[model samples]
Target: MSNIIANQLDLFGAEEQSELFDEDAPTVYYHGDPDRVHARLHRLIAEARGAETLPWDQDSTRLYRKIVPQMVLWLPEEEAAQLRFEFEAELERMKAA
Candidate 1:
């Protein structure tokens, strides 16, 4: 794995990204816990809110790419729909700035 993937796995765990994968897509094993997924999601939400007050350059694509996948993975089936709606809304907010 590349450094980015390794770093992401270290930070968010393998399972968080695995949850976002389609079972039918391919057979790749990821070792991440759901609890870790949940915690990371909450942290990202807090960070995004804080980023609002920071300078524009401080707001970069790297931050979005890192956090978005965790948010998607943290959302469960029942809550997934609502979470996606909120995610898109936040993404739009990011794009506007």
Candidate 2:
């Protein structure tokens, strides 16, 4: 009788033991190519500098405000700091206007 019940469970795809999560899984991060990132940051800086006022919509502005500084970290220390400073300065300039 027990063997028959086990066979029925097996036929129905029941598992006697299972884990809902795996703790040992490896985590992956994808940081884009440094030269590409640098170019993107430069373009963003140039666009902001060219604008007579804030260049992006409020949501886009907020997104850039939050991410640009963080993204700069993928660059060399000196370059990152320069880009971050330029981006922030432009934002402040636009806001003050």
The local lDDT score (0 to 100) that residue 77 gets in candidate 2 is 94
lDDT of 2 by residue, 1-97 (tens): 9999879877745454333244675676998788998999999999999997998999999999898888988899999999999999998988888
How far in Å is the alpha carbon of 78 misplaced in model 2? 1.1
The number of the candidate with the highest TM-score is 2
**lDDT of each residue in 1-97, candidate 1, tens digit only:** 6988778766856566776656777676774566776666556555655654332354555675556565566457666455555555665576677
Question: How close is every model to the real structure, measured as TM-score?
Answer: 0.43, 0.72
Q: Count clashing residue pairs per candidate.
A: 1, 0
- Quantify all predictions' global Cα lDDT against the true fold: 0.59, 0.86
What would the TM-score be for candidate 2 when compared with the true structure?
0.72
Q: After superposition, how far is residue 87 of candidate 2 from its true place, in Å?
A: 0.5
Error of 1 at 25 (Å): 20
Error of 1 at 92 (Å): 1.4
